[model samples]
Target: MPEPIKVLVTGAAGQIAYSLLYSVAKGDVFGKDQPIILVLLDITPMMEVLKGVVMELQDCALPLVQEMIPTDKIEEAFKDIDAALLVGAMPRRDGMERKDLLAANVKIFQEQGKALDHYAKKTVKVVVVGNPANTNAFICSKFAPSIPKENFSALTRLDQNRAQAQIAGRLNVPNNAVKNCIIWGNHSSTQFPDVSHATVTKNGVVQPVAEAVKDDHWLNNEFIKTVQNRGAAVIKARKLSSAMSAAKAICDHMRDWWFGTHEGEWVSMAVPSDGSYEIEQDLMYSFPVNIKNGKYTIVQGLKIDDNAREKMNVTMKELKEEREMALAACQE
Candidate 1:
């Protein structure tokens, strides 16, 4: 067999990593034929827990993973790795400010980003699954100067999927019928799930974007409010945290990027800006993207109606302000 692909997951001891490492081994993200060399990294104490997880992965005998490594050294763990999953972070407690969370996580991602610049494989694509993930991803990419800015993304696919499922349920069709749903801006509550561009269908007929069969107006303000707040609902229901679904988002984000987007179908991801759709550079805000030839390019020239533009603008503003705050903190 050809050499396995080297994939790295920081914070292998965390709950999201708990689910993600197994999925990677079983070919959930990478293809089954593509064997993976799983490089697991965490703080020193988590190595023991990560080791137990690795032992189970070994027994499963997946064609996807050839080996697993549990390490604490950022430089060594990321060395020449194919893809990096960043799930380890300083999570926000109930009373903490977002800036405080970002400040703490920024320090962690910065060191790793430098290590990635020095040691990660030339083509490593990073997905940040941590809290304040968008800003953390921005900090990580900023530290790694040589890598293509497009190679870094934060997880917003979960919000996208959540919106799609909500629409599908409302329309009484399978989730597959929902297309072109978007989560623009930060992965936090500020995300805007716009279905304005979607073609929702049921049975054999296509319908407009609406919450009800009678009313074709789901891309309206109320639905936008609902989709953006769905994260809080999940937290309330689970009464703990959003780990499993977050892991699923990490899986879906990479899977769609690696596999081509469905023909003419675009999804939401927090790709870096090249001034696409008026988003500034390096802010890590979510945008509508279609993957072609293993690269994600923002879908261009879509008619941005007034509501869409307003939503995009608000999210972009939050990202821009966050970027400024981060730069100031970096100087401190």
Candidate 2:
């Protein structure tokens, strides 16, 4: 048997991890043929909880999970890992400001980024899932100078999933019918869930989203707002942030990233920008991307009409401000 690859999950005791660990162990993210070692890490105070989580995994007797290591030490967690799911970050309190939340997470990601640089494999793939994920991912990539920028990404798959689901519900088609939904810029409220290039298939006939929806006013307004605020809606309904759906989205993200996207389709990932679509350079901005052989290239040359351009600009401005705030936080 080939040696098992090590996959690290930070914030292993959190709610999202609670759901995520199971799917990963069942061979949902990586292929079923590959064996994996699960390295679970959380803060010192969460050690007991993490231990229980680890114990549960052991009880499952999953064949793909060759070994499980639960740790509170960052150095131990990072060492020689093949991939990292960076899910930990300080959460925003009820009365706290956005900058304060960014400052708190900056310290966490910077430390983890340095650990990734010093300990993780050079080819490690990282996807940051914490709150303010785009900015946090940018901070992480900055601290890990040696790792290629393409090695890192922020989780915008959840937003993309939300957008696709909304469009499907509107058109009375299955969610899988929606294709090429693009989420532009940050993971925050300013994100532009664009359907300009999206298409939906119903009864085996593919039609552009605008044509199928046939209500530009609703598509331009309600649809976008619903996707942007879906997180809040989930929170309000459950009295907790999304866990099951978030975990599933994370799995979808890593799975597609490892294997490649299908032909003629693209997904949203917040990766370091190289001025694609005139977005600011080096800011972790979300764009439609296609992956091949474990590398991602931004989908280029799509025409951005006036409405799409305006929406993109709003998200771009927010991401720029976020990058500024995240950099300032790094200095502290």
RMSD list, candidates in order: 1.8, 1.1
Weakest 10 consecutive residues of candidate 2 by summed lDDT:
90-99
Note the residue pairs that clash in candidate 1: 36-64, 210-218
Report the lDDT of model 2 for residue 49.
94
| lDDT digits (tens) for residues 188-230 of candidate 2 | 7789999989999998999899999889999888888998988
- The model with the greatest lDDT is 2
Off by over 4 Å in 1: 211-219
Residue lDDT tens for model 1, 1-332 = 56788999888887778777788788888887788888888898877887887787778777666677788888779898889998888765554677888778777888888888999887998998776888888988998999888899999998998888878887778988888888888987777788767777776777666534455454475567777877666667765457788888888899888887988789899988888777777689888899987799888887788877887888888887778877677767
Where model 2 places Cα greater than 4 Å from the true spot, the runs are 93-96
**What CA RMSD would candidate 1 show?**
1.8
Best by TM-score: 2
